[model samples]
Target: MASSTASQQPAQVWDESQCVAALAQLERLQAQIDDLRLTIPRVVAPLSPQITKRPELFAAFKKAAVGSQSNIKAFRTTWQSQETQALFEHTKASLEANSDLTPGAQLPRYGWEQKEIRDRDAEARRRDGAKDGEDKAVVSMSKEERERILQEFRAANGQLKVFSKDDDRDILIHFISGGLKYRFHVVVNSETNGGEHLDAECLGNGEPFVSITRCVSLRPHANELKPLLDMIAAYKNVQSNSCAKCGKLLDKSALVPTARRSKQPEEANEKQETVWEALHESCLD
Candidate 1:
């Protein structure tokens, strides 16, 4: 019984020679196959059949397309007046009915407010305000009003030149007297000067022109006004500006403001708070 069992078991053979022979046969077969492939003419693949449409099928398709198009065309005019409008109203009503809350029903709010859209709207408002002559030192005046004011000033000052800068944020006046150019700016509040309307203070005909001492004297003597013009040109065009009273570098903050002479003859005597001079606070002290 033990011998029969041992004979039934398969024998494990370790033959290197047979394995080498099998590998040689495989290599030879592969080489012959490769050579045979090279010797044979390459078979060109046949072109696919061009799918020509059948006359009857095409005709049927055209008929169907024409019928569909005609049907659409027939409804096009009346669709807006009848079906489309009715459907739109029905949809709107349905949406409203669904959206409306019942007596005791609560709906969870999920969406957030669009901040980007809000920011864009705010920016647009700011730009509109700026374009409408808001926050300028010179008040917002109509073209007619501006012309009237200019004519009034020109009549008294004798052809004064006016220039606007910083999108008309600042208005510069050049008074040509004694063969000298006396430059001055229309008065605007230094604090919050470029901010919106400066709280509406610059909404009307802006404050009167303020003087920078000696730039425009009651009398335009060449000797007195010419040197002052030179100093003003230097002060404005260049950085360094010294106080007239004290030869120290004048700081914009340290400068004290005094009422400027009014351009309006009617308002000359009235107590004006327009800043005419920029003097050292220490000098005032």
Candidate 2:
């Protein structure tokens, strides 16, 4: 308990300037220590995912992530500040440093090569997951299981109202977002559909929901109802992120919230997920 309490202390924020200053102080302290022929236990860099087992450690990381603007994704591109770039470089360097380079196994380079390697790794993971997914394939669900899942799903969301419960496999639901009611037809996978997944389509939008579709078929997930929830949340995000100026969820280009407008523009850029007015890039003019 004493060691646990000691380890969970709030981290000191090490901005670039602070890091430089600390290293300078450490140099002077090391000289003094050498003069006295004394030594002290150095700070060991943490390699554990359990570094954030305590709430304080988690909050500290959250603070650093927010401070660096590393958590922000704009137009599906990550906002990598200098601090985050340094962190990325250090992470790759650390892996190379620790790895046993037997003969010619090179660490992935930061370019198209890295991306290709990652893509290959992702494909391999998908193939592995597909074999595992066979066990929990939506086609294997019994009528009672399907009905119960749909009922629990309907109960979970206030926006989704059941339009029809006729087919146990096909669930038709009505959702309200941006003051517009949208109907969705959800079909759990079966042999007819090539098995192992479920997906939805907005009756009004005519094949929208890129995120949910990707999530349902591509992403490896254990929860069966996550894609359904994602479907609702996607519309909810569209509702909450209406263009402040034009009062529309989508621009004339039919893009939903690719930009943001805040009273404090610097804060909007610097901070993570601020209470900024969401907008489409076309509406900025």
Candidate 3:
């Protein structure tokens, strides 16, 4: 029984090897047949019964053959010479010219180009005039004019006042003058109705008070004037009265009066205060 089983196993192994070899040979034969099928021409022979019976077909074939030969010769000649590149360029240009169906499509309009140039020149001139005008205006003011303006500003706002030695009036003046382009000093004295005064000094060739200074007397609780400065900066561009806190739009009539501390007290028990304000009405809501 053992010998019979061993003999059966060898027979089964031989059969499996034979099947694998047969499949490989079949695959190779199929691949060769596929290659031959692709290489073979699909068209019927020119001398086939249908073509042979038609006289016109023979004439057409002859004409096609002659034309093909001529084309081949022309291609050879052109490909072997520098004139080939020039001919290709000429053909491309001709095709491009013919492709443009629109009228006056070859070049842009002269008037349009001139207008663009003129507009640019005008814009440049306007910008230069604006820059020069600003510089001149800032530098044109005399020292006396600056002093007078400062005095007027202080008087109108009631900023001038005399205080005790420990008062922060001098510090407040420094803050205001620092905002100006020119280096001006603030002088506090008895004659000055406000607690502050500005000395004569020439600022550079820039806009006067272009910088926003700290108004220490107003909103003394605030540490920095950055919020007001930002508002002022934005105001310089768009001339609208907006709420400094909420950025809501406000009308001229919306501004109200407010009080600020003054330099001195007229009576022993009473304190002096400056009266002016521009609170946006919308802010109250």
Candidate 4:
């Protein structure tokens, strides 16, 4: 009975490889958490007087502060015992000795897979899941619903000059930010099945939009578009003030990055996603 019990105990599976990978991932993530804790509030605190005019923007900064606290809480749950590394080593040895394993046995899954691996899986799933659902949603949304959503967008920007000819199926929002008037259109259903953006002319009498591709937002409900508007302002800032490649206020050409677009890093979000900032064109290489 003693021998049988000892044999059964070794059956518990373990992988030192996963343990090692998890530690490496945690170290990288902890560095990001540290950076956010120190930098976010310092950067935004001076803007307190500015954002108060729009309470929602102030609230956003508060939300970010709470998120930083949450990341601190999460670190407490990482490796509960100091013996975790030693335990993983011991457990793996036992698992290796249990030579009774089958040739094609399935391994239990944990959500700690690397971000790139998960991204590939997510992309494949998104492609497979794509269909005419967005189009159908446009048909179902009522004019009343569209009006309510637009009203929420305008509530924060009283100077907004909103117009659209998409039969309540899309939106055109014109608002002032940084003392300059700018506008963008949202297609309730993107691709409009090959139609142009809700807006006719874009910045600088440019054609359509900042991007050649379609971008759409189908929200779960009507909410203030403060975040979206903030994104637009940040985009303008990068274009006019900073070099994306070097993250300097000005580049060698004495110009802000002419390029635009922001991508999330794998180390992003120990709590919530970090803000997307502007970039330089040649940095793409």
Candidate 5:
């Protein structure tokens, strides 16, 4: 009976290669996890003034503020009388006016108008003090300022040509850059199309894709035309190196309008006027 039991018992075997392969796979998986941890982007806090400091605390505070508003609204709706509601609204308006933070707040609205008048007066003084009309209009602008203006124009027009008339609106100014002439148009009641006006094109150089483009807010500002003027001044006065895209040396003298019509008298009258500005011929597009 013992011999029969021994014959029936199976042999125990350990494969060294299988164990090594399993261990190798486990190590590889661990390394992949470690690499993933290092590559993942970390979450960042918002930089708004309200949340710049103690952003985590600000998140909690915002939640609590929202809850408080809900509670107040419920209480007002359930128990407050109509007269009380009117009084509450009036008090809220008064507080917002005093704070000068709310949109269309009385104090802020008037303050903005006053500020505009002051700025215009200051500009007029500076202009008068300058050597000539051209010098008077020369306002030093930063790259940021130029970008902001360009963006605003792009948002409205979807595409501004170097010197082509837009069928939709009136062209306000002709801008020249890199030997390319751009027409700036005034968009009346420019509305947001799916969060942006994305169709703006650069029709200068006859080819729309020659230059870099960007978008800005469609809302108008005081001295709405000044940014365009500033950009023209910058392009004319600032000496730049080779074309940003192609790295080719640009001739400043070669700058010309892209939309010059053939010598038909009627067409010539309608064609964009050629204006001299500093820009490279290849860069204008």
Candidate 6:
């Protein structure tokens, strides 16, 4: 009986090992099937007609895009118009507020006009009495005044000159209509960009008036000339090698005189010649 039992046990063990191997093989085959199922769809998807029909959809999308662009353009135009109107209204209000226009019969005095007249009267008085205290004032004045009174006054005191002397450059007084007044210093160089050279500051301001090509016919008149010259001289003396408009040291050679059509046609003539000038950036202050 013991021999029979030993033989049965070996048979049972062999059967268990075979069952385990068969189950492992079955699990591997199932895993392979699952992998195939996942890969087949990915490989065939690109070859399918449904996936390749994207070009047609894109064409329709482009047609719709045109309408969107038109809408954007219309919106931009409307916005720009509204902005312009607002700016115009604000400017008009500011002008009216500053103007001497009165609601009733009370005569309104223009503030700037009154100030200008007062300044002119004071200047006249100074000029009239200039020689009276000359002897007494000579010792009190600095060596700079002894060397050059007009030039020193312009340089130290920021007095604008309209024309250039041997020692001083010309000044340009900008009488902007619509209540804008400014001044600058300028020099005319006949050799620069076909007879054009401008102040370093004017070129740096990024304004319309800084181009040599534009200044071809712009010139200063008798009334405008002296003031412009004085302004330039004052700028030259005070600013020296710095940009008059920006107070930056700029390459003088890169500066080119530029001119633009004046905003006020009544202030300038058609045949005038424009030149370039420099100014203290602080003058704008």
Q: Candidate 1, overall lDDT?
A: 0.36
Give the per-residue lDDT of model 5 (tens digit) for 1-285: 123323222232224333233334334444444444432121121333455458666675666556555655554453355534443344444444355554433221112222233334444543553324332332233446545555565555433333323332233545565575655343322333311111233333312222211111111121244433334333333444344334445323232222211111344556552332333333332
In model 4, the runs with Cα more than 4 Å from the true position are 1-145, 158-160, 165-167, 176-180, 186-201, 206-230, 233-245, 249-255, 258-276
lDDT per residue for candidate 2 within 99-139, as digits (tens), equals 54542234211222222333345456658777887677454
Clashes of 2: 0
RMSD of each: 36.6, 22.4, 34.1, 22.1, 29.0, 34.5
In the predicted model 3, the residue pairs found to clash are: 160-193, 160-194, 160-195, 161-194, 161-195, 182-203, 187-197
Of the two candidates 2 and 3, the one with more favorable lDDT, higher being better, is: 2
Q: How many clashing residue pairs are found in candidate 5? A: 13
Off by over 4 Å in 2: 1-139, 192-196, 205-223, 237-254, 257-285
Per-residue C-alpha lDDT of model 6 across residues 29-57, encoded as one tens digit per residue: 44444544544444444454654577865
Question: How do the residues 105-150 of candidate 3 rate in per-residue lDDT, one tens digit apiece?
Answer: 5422222322233334444654665455444412232345434544
- Cα-based lDDT at residue 222, candidate 3: 25
Candidate 6: residue 225 lDDT (0-100): 29
TM-score of each model, in listed order: 0.20, 0.33, 0.16, 0.30, 0.19, 0.20
What overall lDDT goes with each candidate model? 0.36, 0.47, 0.33, 0.45, 0.36, 0.36
> How high is the lDDT of residue 283 in model 6?
22
| 46 Cα displacement, candidate 5 (Å) | 60
TM-score pick, better of 1 and 3: 1
The candidate maximizing TM-score is 2
Clashes of each: 1, 0, 7, 1, 13, 37
